[model samples]
Target chain A: MHPADEVLVARYVEEADQAAFRTLVDRHQERVFGYLRGMVKDRDVANDLFQETFFRVIRALNKERGSYTRQGKFLGWVLRIARNAALDHLRARKKWQDLGNGDDGDESAWWDRLPDDGPSALESVQDMEEADLLKACIDRLPPEQREVVLLRHESDLTFREIADMTDCSINTALGRMRYALINLRRMMEEAKRLEHIPASD
Target chain B: MHNGKKDILLHLYGEATDAEELRSLLRDEELRREHAALSEAKFRLDHLKRERPDPVIMDRILAAAAGEQGLPSSTDRKDRPAVARSARMRKVMLPALTIAAAILFGVAVGWFSSQPGTAQVDEPAVATAPDDIVPPESLYRFVPPQPVTPASTQDPRLAWDDSAPLMDMHRRIESMRPEGMLDWGEQAVPLESLPGSGSRSLQLTGSNKN
Candidate 1:
């Protein structure tokens, strides 16, 4: 949550500042945890990967003798860590399969929304419908296209960064983005229309 | 009407050479609607990011990496092959190390040759230190000079080089002396002393051998 996580991170390395580290964890844990959950689809697996991300940071911090590079850009690097952890987990399991719906269910429908506020609205039900529809649409995409869309759009990473995080080239990243957009259009046109949107159950 | 150039939407998003032309293509109402629809669908897909992770599984990952995965920590960083480190070092160290090793090998050969009396040394050379380190003044100290013992009987090989020609010259001189001309029963000189006198005496003795 720090505007620049680098400073507190650097301090956390230099000094064994548990408070500083906790601050960092508290700030970014939600988003990071959310990301891993989105990736592996299993609650246990996502949590394991999330814990491993911090463990790796600690190990790298301690082993390298108390020096750290914030690298000005932190989320991309952290996401790369999460992405690698998921891939490695997948590889170890010998199950190169499509990502599944994660535990606690996916609420990705909050990412790109036109902000809504009604005078007496207890909830904005359109968002939930959007989230459910988005989930179905994502599930329907080819695995590669699906991953590219998730990493770039929902994860809010640039295409080149996604390429690096996913172990692909920038050009491949661009191509995937292009195809993902084209496919999104096709999938939307195919979805059956409902007369009235349902409120959240 | 779908402009034949609808593919240019990707270029407009990317760094295409013909971006202005793509923008012009987007001005068409049908293509514009299609683009808007594509954007909306993408936005819908992009927003699905509010997933939560189960807490218990996170504990295990940290535990496993911490070596509490039911095993004690192997804290030593030794087992990992230096492949990654060497790969990282290749940028600066590989060439520098190569040049340094070459210089060291050259210096070693030069020093070995110049240390005087290496011909008498029978031991094969061994590398004593790293190739990059310049040997201190003390490095040559261990290469003790072999004690040059003067032979009492003389090596036949040394004698072949030193005393053989002189002996032959002495015999020839004795034959030429007509006997009783000098000591040793036939005026022959000692085989060892003639060449020991110097090159001038050896040449004279050789000339007189006939």
Candidate 2:
């Protein structure tokens, strides 16, 4: 079994171990990036926020080596920071029209920007298509619902943890998750219905 | 074992739920259907793509962790020139500010010394006697003292007689004492001249007198 997150954090903080820090980043980067991507709905902005989030993590860990006493909840703490970074980006984008520019306009813009090496086989391509569809549906969710879903799935946090991170009641977190699932189901059914509609001659 | 949606969710997500509650939830047709749909939705959500950020971003973060670079800003590459310019300005402005502050301090010191009434502490103190000496009896009459010249301008060779006032005050206090009080002048009293002379002389000689 690998060392726990707290052990890795201790190694990184006390010893200034770059390898330990890299392990932390690697262990959590996909979850963090995926959560950010779901939050912002823009790959490039998510990339920026991902970097910003880890940068903040490093700074906080270095400056406050003694302050990280949240023994087993490292990913939850990091996701909270990531959530704030994504929200700040979104708020700034909303405040200044010129900040995001054309980036925030088309949610599907990231699809076009996907790397050319993606999913060469037919089965993988079909899976990618289904993922893309589900992502679009997730993007269509209300911010609160999407946040609940993303934090739950990406970070694997409990409803109580998500509630604490998002500053809501545990019941509220559960309610949002329930609504998100219901909405996703509805949207998937709607998409399937539309896919089955025959083209006009 | 009555199951609410939250209980169903807790049971669904593998959060701690009663086994009886889970069995009851699965037993109810409506709750079971709801659970099935939500489970399907969750499964689909799990299939959502996970992407990694560019390795360059990680490198920058690690470099910041290593203290080789500053905190990574969101627009690092786009704002590098501005950052560099700011750095160059800081490098030039810091020493310039130190020199400017030093010069300002020097000018302030010079300007203050050139002012008329400022104390010249290093110059030897000049001691001058008062223009009019008051007699010891007149000390009680509150004489309005003369305005003394600044130490820097007074004659350094004249030594101040500071003890004159103190001696006068001592004489005034001595005159205030009651007239009949025994003056224990500069000599010790003899034991034979004591109030109880025999007992006092015996005590002093350490002899018992019956």
lDDT of each: 0.57, 0.74
lDDT of 1 by residue, B57-149 (tens): 545544543446642233532443476677769977989999999999999998897775883453233344346465797676778789887
Q: For each prediction, how big is the interface RMSD?
A: 6.8, 4.7
The DockQ leader among the candidates is 2
True lDDT of residue A53, candidate 2:
85
What's the true lDDT of residue B185 in model 1? 58
In terms of TM-score, which candidate is strongest?
2
- What would the per-residue lDDT of candidate 1 be over residues A1-201, giving only the tens digit for each residue? 354577766666677665566566666666677666655556677777787776666665556323235676566766666766777776676534543322222223322321222221113323435555555555445455656676765566665566676666655555555555666565455443331445448
Give the poorly placed runs of model 1, Cα more than 4 Å off: A64-69, A97-129, A193-201, B1-25, B28-34, B54-210
DockQ of prediction 1: 0.19
Give the clashing residue pairs of candidate 1, or none: A47-B58, A108-B47, A108-B48, A108-B49, A109-B48, A111-B47
lDDT of 2: 0.74
Candidate 2 lDDT for residue B109: 100
Clashing pairs in 2: none
